[model samples]
Target: MNLVPLDLDRDLELLHAWVTHPRSHFWGLQGADPQRVRAEYERIAADPHHHAWLGLDDDGTPLFLAETYDPAHSELAEHYPVRPGDLGMHVLVAPPTRQRSGVTSAVMRAVMDFCFAQPGVDRVVVEPDVRNEAIARKNAEVGFVEERHVTLRDKVARLSFCTRTAYAMSAPHLQPAAIAYAHRRLIAKAIAEFSHERLIEPIAEGTGRYRVGDLAFTARRYALNHWVVDADSLTGPLDALDFIAGLRETLGIPEKLLGTYLEEISATLAGTAWKVTHRRESAAELVHADFQTIEAAMTEGHPGFVANNGRIGFGLQDHEAFAPEAGRPVRLRWVAVRKDESLFVTAGDEREHYLAELGEPTLARYERQLRGHGLDPDDYRYLPVHPWQWEHKVTVTFAPDVARRSIVPLDEGPDRYRAQQSIRTFFNVDRPERHYVKTAIAVQNMGFLRGLSPKYMQATPPINEWVRQLVDGDEELRACGFGVLRELASIGYTGDAYHRTGTPGAYTKMLAALWRESPVPRLAAGERLATMASLLHRDRDGNALVSALIAASGRSAAEWVAAYFRAYLRPIVHCLLRHDLAFMPHGENLILVLENHVPRRVFMKDIGEEVAVMNDQPLPAEVERIRIDVTDEIKELALFTDVFDGFLRHLAGILASDGVLPEREFWALAGDCVRAHAKDHPELTGRLDLLRPTFKHSCLNRLQLRNTLQMVDLTDQAGSLIFAGELENPIAVFG
Candidate 1:
């Protein structure tokens, strides 16, 4: 059984049916209308003490309702002594289903499992109608001991309690079917992505089956244009580490890369296990949740990458506190760095602007802390550091700075932040309108050691300003509703001639921070924000987030697709054609501004690290560093490779798989968006033809497979690219 948060609005009708059924006389609602049901549940939803949930079977059918409440404030509290960790709950199984042996017991056990899973929940208390012998017996099966008789609002109930130990001893382990299902899905992803990258070859066995590693691995055709690895072929229970080990030789993995890659795979599996054990919200409910809540609740990381959630440096406890998937709030550790040894840059009025944003009282407190250490406030600046970095990397790796009094730890700031999808960047949850702080840490994830380069920080602000000015000056970009989230300021302190693990260029990136303009202040009235990654989000029930947004828009799926392409794709193509510019338009780098669930515009970010200019065109000397010389033949790859192959391919795949928009139609719409931009710019007619925008398939997995520790040589980014020949461009068919 799957236990999930109850979405009252979506499940109101079904709940009303269950509550008013003839067998549900104890529920006390026999003649209720839709309005009555809404009013009643809305009250419960508003109360901080009470919460409801729905349980579903493997097939996604709702089978029961479970309500949990704070027993300290509950009706049962008046009757029984409430312990510190006690929780009150009520359960209602759907009617008319045969009460077979172990059926009700199974549901009760699942409910108990969910309750105990919560932090600090040591015991669960329940009160069922005394006449309900069946429910009393079900509770006993799950280790609930009868405590006493209690009078609830409208019924006499048999009070029972189950301690955490009793529940753990009596409850069943996660069924083998569930474990097998998770393993099959993960294995399928590994095989499909590895095959697509041309790292491993799968032998077709005809009739929709394929074998890898001399038939040691078998895959069967599955939905969503992918295959499912058969769990039965494995000699024992499925283990991701063992499975990868078996395929290493066949995939031609080197010794070093293979070991690190296995570490990443292990981390990813651990994260998946935690999610499977704790997730309690259905896709439909998640789709309707508030924007930031949805961002934190996302289960999948990158759809294409196998070890996307590696989070190599994080310990198990750190993962819980800092990982975005954990959805926990973090308080960043602040430090004071000596200005004589640090670098600082700002875009706008630095003192007045920042002081106003971060209240004067806060700034004064930070400065006073510096004076307390006998350091002049004039010689120092504040720096925000990740808590985990302070504990692991900073305290140990940057010990010299600490010893020399160059870096002094300060008290934690008052604001609370949530780690965004990118582990280093944080969104200001305490004050939603504040700028996001992107900090530096030495952690290896997704093919790179994710650290902010001190030199890179120097050019970030100006590059963002240059891009912002370009967008502001272009009539086409304005017409297409393009905007930019600028990196307004940056600060860094690097130790001279530093080296860790004897790798060159890795040491100088140890300490740095930047503040990027938040999209919140720029949002127009009636417009809400969501990450572009939502387009690729598929819930556990196989419903796509984009599809849900389209439904909410009340527009036909095709209309929504056209609007998205116009807002997103057209701006990207125009930038490439007119300015020889491109951005890392990957899902995480762009934020979609939605008005009534219809995408209106997009804000581009990650400019310094990911944006590039691919021609010899003259630019301001200060910003000329953004330019990268590329062969004229592949310059258009700025668009075809970055936007199309990198981002649109996966989005189109998701939409097509869900039947929201056919695969052919999705590419056709993209082609139309590009052609429309080309037609609007007659001056660039010759340039467009020379830059025939067909994509070569760049193998992202190959980069990791070759060097999981540091996938790309940062100094030679373009030269480090690995490609698996070419794919027939999906949009080429349109031309």
Candidate 2:
């Protein structure tokens, strides 16, 4: 492609045809006459600060129109401060004669290259209309960081900027230094988690020195078999692939699964490298940042899993467009499925919920689309799908349904969503109060294919409703503001061909989604939301976000942790002993509501699949699937392994390493919280032992290592757990 100065007279007809097309409505010149187009270009030509260019192909055919101006002298200066060397840019691709792949992206890259090539240009500014989400995503592809909305002369626009350094880092390949840095950090994590699980025991060489194979590192042993490995002190191959390969025998990874495991490791390394190169905020800055900002700023994923970020099906482009850490806004693709072939369940009026989720205008548009396809709107239900899943899986695997009009593809939804750390769930960034849409994608991530079982989704809402009522009726829970983000609705499409296979696997579980309640509406005045995973976040400079939050709250580290336990741990304990219920309250599965940077309460999510009634508690017929029979010993592991070893041990290690709090004090505060809760409810004091000396060590990496495809049976998770011998309960000493 080539860029040349656009001639107002010679290019007038071509430019008019391109800008006046209906698809170019965002260009703000739709239905304009040729003369009107000429007047606009003439004004730009007369101005010394602005210039227009025509992008042409090898055959000299016009492909796109580009514009550049000096932001200091433009209308943008009125909204925000403009730096010296800031260049403003706009690009509009010509209406396509046929469907072409990567054309718009190519044109965008060309425009970015042209702008940065200017003599004084150091940053490129763009103000795309806020409603034009397609253009906003395109802008983000080239590394534009969105600021706030600015009112321009014609429309409200999202002001964004891209620095030369950021654009370079957004490239597909990482710099050598970044790759090496990511490898060292990942190698350290692998060593730590593996040793903790007793997969590869590190030989003690000297004080705080250990050797794994030929690799040597300095690490401190903490409570609950935790290893705090120092990344800088690690010596040997810094490549995560080689590191995993060296321990394949000891990890007990089968020969057939080794290659796939290595692929996961590579993907994890690439993701870490991208985050290391593109991180924009420090730990302190994230302390005051908004909810989504702190969420995407999280660097570590599932402190236990070594290959936690192994999005195996995503290509380089998908990583940039959908990865949570990428911080890109996404628009979900909507589809209409025949009512007979789909199931829709809700806790409230379905039509009213749909109208709110997809505004009235969008709902009307979708109804019109169905009528155009010669189908009645009342005969079908609407469902949202991940764009990647729709393009890659639905279009091909469900072709029979598409061809028969059982599943008709509609346009993208208007609201923009951001992928959460869980990857399948999305938060509505455009409308904060809207429900979180969790879609199914048949991509293999950490331990299993990330697909929602449509059969199981049938009872999701009822299970959530049951749990909601239980929490509301508990006096202590209501006082603490501990609640759940209910999975209020669900919809799933079953294809005829795959449905008859009688197999329950990824293929059968492809097209399903659930709507979970958003935490935004539950917030009080002066309160903010942050994912509990942010507590484990350490910035590129080795600063902990949790430590920063403690300092901001004007409380000592011990005091802040005590408050956190009240908000987070006490509820889980209450539900277990008081209600005979167990929830998978891992960091990613929880949300913390904060005021003045101190956690006041918590919200648990991912309910239908993760929660269980461990004992013989009577449940509603619709929610009976959650009932699980387990041994008393295994029931105790719910707190000992999941809460203590899985989550708090890691938190203790981080605080101790940062010198903010001692591990002993951290465990003591936790014990005090549990004891205080027991004191308040005297009848529940002896129901469960909180100070057990030891509990079976539940191994997470072992599950993934055994079967990278499907780690555990969803229906019998507790029965399928892989366990190492035992771990000493950290809080036992407090008793």
Candidate 3:
């Protein structure tokens, strides 16, 4: 059903007939005429506190009348204390047209859905007449909890309310459907990723069916490149812990990693449950939303990593407020660090310039906070801290710094920031032009303690500035719109008293922050930005964001793929072969610049840590820290493993599964991009060709499977990779 804003002029007569009927006597409009209905609806349309909607069936026939109002401003004001998210609503279906069995119930559900769709509406308040037994029974069916009788303008009413959670439970279709969808998707990922990691060897039992560990543990082909583990294969219910326990011996996961991994898996499952329960938008609706909305709507966390959302320190409440999936804007907690114990670096701007961006009022307030503690504001540098870190880590773990007055906690900053897919990094939503603030939070997620190392902060701006200079000087890169959201400034608080070892530990990293330039200010007039991760996104309804983009671009899938390669893949290839440079160019690390939903350019981020100079290449003295000495044989996996197998392989599978493009065509396009880049730089032919053959498959899950607590060594990120037997490159066929 489509909800049309109540047309007071056109709907007056129809609305009068329905509300004045004996069935709608509780509505208190029984004796109302057309003029009276018009006056009432006109007043509703005029009032900001109230709204009326007409629900129409598929054939454009009016089926129901719904009214949504602010409980605080409406007739219910004095009767009850209105909550922040409470919205008053009433529903009346068109009188008995041959009384279909479930039609009334369905209409009620639709009305409630329409009401809850409005932002800030967490609960719906309804005050049906106390005498209306039928309406009361119908309300209870949808999870309404009756409180007490209350006197309204015209009649005594039963005050009832239905929370979002209550409605999700009472409305069976949503929870069951979401659970089935989430479970199927998660199971498919576990089977595929675990299999790829060689954690479980599956023997083919029959067509599209395979058995793993035991004959009873079986799975069938699921999506384009994944599998669905059968529920019946499990000894009992489909619990992730139980499933892992069953396969522990076969997979050879250590006792230490296994227990930590289970905690991660449990957290992942909990996140999925929250997402499924809270989601209201359909895939189509999400497709039409703005970039950030589409980003927040992405429910499938990662295509390959099964325990992708293991925010270990986050409980349910913390997850709801801080997780990127939660989509809630957060205010960052601020702190002042003494100058002697802190290091502040910037691209060109001074600390004062960055502070000015926080607005004069916020700057004054921060200064006042420092002065209140009898400290000079000039002697300290200000840094934003994650609220969770302040509550859990900084307060307890770094108590010495707090006690000595080296690190003084300040007030919350003015801007509302949104947690990007990388949880610690925050986008300034309150002022989009402001730089992104990346803070250190001592939390374990996706196999790493996600704390920013204070040691790395010294070289952060220099590394980014070097990359910016290279891109600016290169004609090809400049022409292709290759850009970086520079980590313009960084600050790390190193309290010597806290870490006696002189090496930065978890506690030392707890108070550091870096600010990167926002991509929003750099966007051209016609261009919009979306995270490249959206390419692999499939909504809860299994609709693809990439497919939607392709449709909106009005280009053939192959044409769109070619354009995307030219903009995204070609740049990475050029950098690797021509400059001996490699980036951790995974999906989340790249931002897609789209012009009318078509790929226009690319913005690479997370560069302070992920960008590296490969093959012992000499860089300038200041930026030489980025250089990593890897053998020539292992160098090419930068493109082959990270670009192809890491991201595009899964993308190709999804596009193929959705019938947007054939799997072969997708790789062929990728191969064509590499060939074109090689032909353009004939001097680098030998270097490029050496990387074309089959390479050892890089197993992402293997890293986490081996050590979920700390997946990779921060000191040597590349050395932490786990590799299995080689797989023939799909693009090799194109050559």
Candidate 4:
């Protein structure tokens, strides 16, 4: 492709046709005549800082239009600080006469190349209309980082920038060396996690040397049967697909699910490749970064599941548009659900409070839309929908309802959100105080189809209210500054087809949303929020974020670990011993509020789906679904398997590998926290044993390997747990 200076008289006809097309509505010239189109370009031609160009194919045929200007002299200068070498750009591809793939992307690359080839250009700037989701995604594909929305005279625009380095890092082709490196790392993790689950027992050749099939690697076995494998020492094929296929029988992967499992492994490898090739910050930089920055920088997904990022329904474009690592701002799709078919529940807030979250303008606009449809706004409730879900599932599966106006599709919400690491949940980046909106998308990820059950949605807010009261009443929990982020409101639309069948399958759970309290309002002075998962994040260079936090805190590694235990682990133990309650306290389920680079307290979330009440305590009828009858052994595994083995074991390996803290010392600090808690509550001491010599080994990957669709029945979690044998408790040695 080549760029030629646009001719005023000759290009007028072509520019008019391009801008007047419906596809170019964002250009704001949809009904322009020939005279208007010519006058606009004539104005640009007269400006010293603005220029227009026509992109031509090698055969000298016009394919697209491009514009360039200096941001220092443009309207953008009023919105953001203008750097010395900031060059603003705009591109519009002509409506295609034939279907073509990669044409738009090629045009984008050529435009970027043309801008950088100029004498003084170091970065490219764009202010596409905020409603143009397509261009925003394409911009991200070429490394544009969405900064924020800027309101202009014509429309609200997303101000984004792309540096030369960022463009280079987002090159379409993956580096061969990077792909090899990613494969080696993933293979090592697979071996470690699979062996830890006792699926493929490695033959012990010598101390620290083991062989799985023909692949030989060195590893050290730690407490909880954890395998810390050496990525550099693996001697066999580094292909994850071939490795999984070879061990299919040993891993007990069913023949029918083998292909799906392999696809997940490939996707995981691709995600890793993207991370390594991108411009990732160092651990020290991330330690001082903001919450969302730390969230997007996470490379590891679950730490235990090998195929953690399956995301089966997401195509490549979906990954770029919606994935957390992409760091692109998203605007949720809104729809009106008929009040009779939908369930809306709230903890204590009224409907007006939830409606006010949309702000007055959006709320008024939505109500107007419902009236336009000849439907009463009072008979409907507005619900947030994941953009992907709106496009893929709702439009297709609920076509009859939409046609009958039972589910009326509305425009995108005004506020921009960022996808959290959990993928389905979104954080309000535009308005930090707004509640987090969690929508259900029918995508298969991790061990189940990621959807919110309407049956569970009915009880979500009440369960959150119960848990909030419990946390508020506990003196020990309050002393540690521990709290729960309540899920205040929820709305779920049950389809007529599935509701009549009375089966709460994935289909019935597809259209539901919940509003949870944001952590932003809970921040104290000098305190910021970071996901607890950030503690386990390692940069591409192998430096641990936890190590960086310790360095920043001006404290010894042991001191920092002790503080972390006090803020995180002690409250978890208190909840279990004093309340007979257990939460799935994985790193992703908790948020750490840090003051001066130290964890001052924690706020637990995902309360409704994860929290379990083990004892047969009397509970409110509305919140009785959380109650579960389990044996003492299963209740003990709540700490042994969920907390120690699932979360802390990975943290221990990260710290040990970084040489910041030894493994033994880490568990000793944890044991000290537990003993202190036990001593404070003598009546609860014998109810559960924290220092048992061994605990049942609950295999996570085994659960997925056995059944990828639904790993375990949520209703019978205790009975569905897959266990191998037993693991020696690291805390037992400290006792």
Candidate 5:
């Protein structure tokens, strides 16, 4: 039985059917005609707390009138804590099919699911006529824990109330969180596999506590300012930000610099919003909406490497096949490179969000749909996924860790040794000879170089047909998925330094594809959570929850990450930057190192949560592993601006003295970052406000802001000189 919100406009029709039936009471509209029943339903619908809906059997036949309400909304506000979050519930099962044993029971389950889903709902109560002892007893069969006869709803009726715990008792009927997690896990996997992947699913949904299938993630999503928090530490919402602010102040950094830092961080967070979504009916919605459209866009023709299993390897496409500029550099791409210039794959952005809009039901339905989809009824996975939530997906990649001896050899120069940070990227289905294209420039800080981060592809053309054949009827995707993984192990991309064990990136991409399919903002109260980090509060239970999360993450990978930071990264930062490298450059572009082929051991946490904090409170245990979040792009840009001016000058000085770097190669590394950013993002047009005459030298180009970056260069005519020649005898102004 599906008990969702009632369409008041159609209530009278259902009421007429019920009243004319064999068992229903006056609810069937006997004394009051159909019009009167419709009028009453409309009246209740007008109020937020009162609602009426028809219960539908599995076959879509309307079985009963399932109505519910808050006693507080019925002139009984004084009886409850109407402090906004609190809610009270009342359920009335009206019928032609009154005591059909299982009908009412099923309807009651549906109502319970709805009640528990109201955000911050504390308790739900149902009022039945005190004389209806039969219903009072039936409530127990339907899983009502605290059923009692009491006055409620401004009426002298026996009332039944249920807490979250009571609602959880129907766990067997709800969808398991593992399903939602599988979706999220796949999203992260797709991001690793595909290009320009964003929105790794949250480690946990925005519940009061932790969730299952929450893989290796340190940052958590609990309220920060809980009254029950212990005084020994100020760890919660603003813990990371507050720590960074205090660190800067204690170190006595000039506010002039701090202002820019704060502004950039704020803007980045504001621009790149984090999001979370859990669709209970996503599978059905996809089927109804034809999700296969995405598959067609990504992989129609390419039959990737045929494995020993006899199935052609297939991967997701970056875009549509008929798309313009088929090989244009995009976040992700599918290509068959006959030669360097012949690389091609059906490619284009799949419009997934639009489809989602057409398929998704209202929030009230989402809860029922989710629960209905799950095997367990009490599982909160049935709850709507939190939209626009903060999450961090850390990518671990490392090349051979360079000891000091190794570093000394690379330096092969004066006390000042130089290393550049470069990024190597690729998309799905490649050949043996295609090594990562080395970018033209590098950052002065070796610490900022990223060797590996979560990356993968193959969302389209779902797993090989052979795997589908071998994995079998029930194990189709799962068995095939595990089998291919073993093959990946053979190729050195699934274990240890060569690879790591985790969900395939295809899952992550499919999720993003799903999000893109439904991009509209369907939020309650129209709040899209405008900021990446919003300040929230929790009670004692919430505080304990946060503490537990912190302790868990801290004990897991957090300590290992922290230790890695100290071992290889810390000394290099201090020894290299005698000028005092601010914040260890780990916001976005600032955190990276090559240990194996993967970029591993990055420590970027505890920065910029509290803007006005003035204490030395210890950092929260949650601030451990950090990665490129929504704000990483802009924050990293800010980090880039911080070091560009000084670092470029140093590079020019050394290159000039050594005279080994080609003129073009020398200038290549100078402003390559900003240049690449400009070329990639056309939206920043007219935003480049470079310093006047700062256009000639890459040094000044590096210091400009997005709103102020001019992409022009400047040089001091008399002092300026390019490689292979000197300036004119007269004053040569740089421009």
Candidate 6:
């Protein structure tokens, strides 16, 4: 209702008109006046017992009156014994709108739901005359049942009650506007396309090599959940060579000496051939490869302990890690298959989920819709499989003889297999705040290519999703930088200040509906704080450089430096690192970002690849709390390394060769971090000592020790670290 306070006198006149008129249905009030209306409204407005708000339709018109009566209020001090989960609420339609079309019923239900949604109230109560047959039916439709009638203020009224359990039984009145449904449908279609492109298309044409559909789309792995080949790809230019030449020509490549710009990486897969013979499922295909190289792409250096993203080398059939920096000794494992070699990462765990979750049991429920929509699952299932490894990835390679003879089984296996998730016990331990907080993230400032140039749009903030989590789930939006923008009101925002311009404008009051439902959640900043801190402290030596500096210098100097950083720097680094956080831990803005990663407090510093618990007095049961339940498990995002040398490796060469900052500057950066949050969180400020390490502590400048030092004498003692590595060629430069 525009969220504006009701015009009490006007509303009273309208109500009085309805009741006194013989045509009135719900109300038959004896009397009401301007003064009486003001007095009643004041009582409601001021009454702690009553929570009153107006309901508005999609167009922001006032729809009805909504208010809740909860027993916990200070005014309702002697109110009846309210249960741990209980609430009461009601809705009165604005007169001249006698149609109780689901909206009013929903309004009443929403008020009751809001009451129950609060931490305490649970049950809702309403009273109406039983003789009003229409209202009785409406209340019943809203999951309200007739209780006993009571004489209150010497007036008999039939009482009714509603419960959370019963709200679902009632039809919901409040709903997303039609536009929202349209948007959701659009999004769903996009998701469908991605699923089809990445995990469903069969007989897809490869840019290199011939299209599998050339021999008819009878591949056995067509139903598998990887590398789906879109049949459309079959019609494109034959190979990478053709595609590249055409691309260059379109980009206006000079005709002269075009050959000098490009080089062939590998010979064509055209020589290799595959065909689908009589197949049970189209996913089955027999392939013959004239193999040259069959090794996994080194996306990561090579991981031995797959859980920890690290480098590993092949030691015959066994795997050995070559971290040369880990010192002492390197570890080796005898696992049969590495992550890259396998079509799916894990077979047992993810297979269990696939078979149980989106498996037949689940698919059956949606099969009618599937069939009704004319979906052939097999045709839509082979998208993400590499052209060569499509079927062989999940099962075994099929020879022409076997393909012609053996009946292929359905492609039933896992795609993203995680061994850690196989166990029934291990779940949700990753998030300590699993019970109370529900989280979501909005991709803010969404800049996408509208035509050619990218245009900016904002996501409807995920605050509503966050509020839902707090009310119904355990997740939360831990993403940083959630609410820095102004309300959509000002110019460049919402132009509601100009009278003529603002007349048909967005109202802050009405926007409250969106804002109320969509609350910008307080970033549950601990994990991000921890990750950022780790990045700041990350030294090539695998220790924190900022920590070491603060230990050497006293707190006061650190305070001054930290002040400059917070005021002049951190914000920029925070914004930049947000997207590529996996790599941001590197000192990107040089020491600028390192200083920004500093946080006010460090709750979980010991956090690493593994999860652990460390509370003062061990809350044994707390670890198994409902928050971290079976349905909730954290997925690791540190699976890929899209970097060549990495930040840690380069720091030493850069510092020691020709471009090192002075030792004093190092301390200044550490001091800057210490001072950033010193004022408000003094305890954390005091713990600056805990951050530092002694030079002799062995976890010293890792990059420095890795190579010989090249020093350039600096007059300013603070710049010594910078001057040390003043080499024309440092170890690694930021790419």
For each candidate in turn, the TM-score is 0.77, 0.80, 0.81, 0.79, 0.27, 0.24
Sorted by lDDT (best first), the order is 2, 4, 3, 1, 5, 6
The TM-score obtained by model 4 is: 0.79
lDDT of 4 at 17: 94
**What is the C-alpha lDDT profile of model 2 across 556-665, one tens digit per residue?**
99889988999999999999999889999999999999999999999999999989997777788999999999877887888988899889999999999999999999
The 10 consecutive residues of candidate 2 with the worst lDDT sum are 168-177
Tens-digit per-residue lDDT, 1-735, candidate 5 = 566677756556766666555444423345666777677777878988777777776447776666666665665554444444445554455553322323455566666666677677767666656666667665655455543445644346655555677555533222333223223323222222111111122233343222213222222111110011112222232322232345454323355555443343332221111101111111111122211121111110111100001011111121111111122222221111111111111123222221222223432343354345442212221101101100111111111211211101110101111111111212111211111111111111111111111122121112122222322332212311111110000000121222333443321211111111111122223212110000011111112111222233334323322333343233222211221112323222222221221222232211221001112233232221112222222232222322322122222222233333322343333334234334544554444232122222112211221111111222111122221111111001111
| Predicted candidate 4 versus true structure: per-residue lDDT over 1-735, tens digit per residue | 799999978888899999899999999998889999999999999999999999996447899999999998999989999998899999999999865445777688779989999998889999999999999988998899999999988999999999988987775525566678778889999999998998888899998999987789999877777888998899987888999999888888899998888888888887787666553567887988999989988988999999988888887678878999877799999999998888889856556765668877888899899999898988888889999999998899888889999899988999999999999999999999899999999988887888987768889999999999999998999999999999989998985587769977888888999999999998888999999999989887778899999999999999999999999999999999888899999999999999999998999999999999988888999889888998888988989999999999999988887788999999999999999988888888698878889989999999888888788999988889898999988998755
Pitting candidate 3 against candidate 6, the one with the higher TM-score is 3
Instruction: List ranges where model 6 is wrong by over 4 Å.
Output: 1-31, 71-84, 97-101, 171-735
For each candidate, the alpha-carbon lDDT, in order, equals: 0.76, 0.90, 0.78, 0.89, 0.29, 0.28
Q: List the residue pairs that clash in candidate 2.
A: none
lDDT of 1 at 360: 91
Q: Rank the candidates by TM-score, best first.
A: 3, 2, 4, 1, 5, 6
Location of the lowest summed lDDT over 10 successive residues in candidate 1: 221-230
Q: How accurate locally is residue 268 in candidate 4, as Cα lDDT from 0 to 100?
A: 84
Candidate 6 C-alpha lDDT tens digits along 1-21: 133455565466553453344
Q: Pick the candidate with the highest lDDT.
A: 2
The prediction achieving the highest TM-score against the true structure is: 3
**lDDT score of residue 557 within candidate 4:** 92
Write down the lDDT that model 5 would get.
0.29
Better of 3 and 4 by lDDT: 4
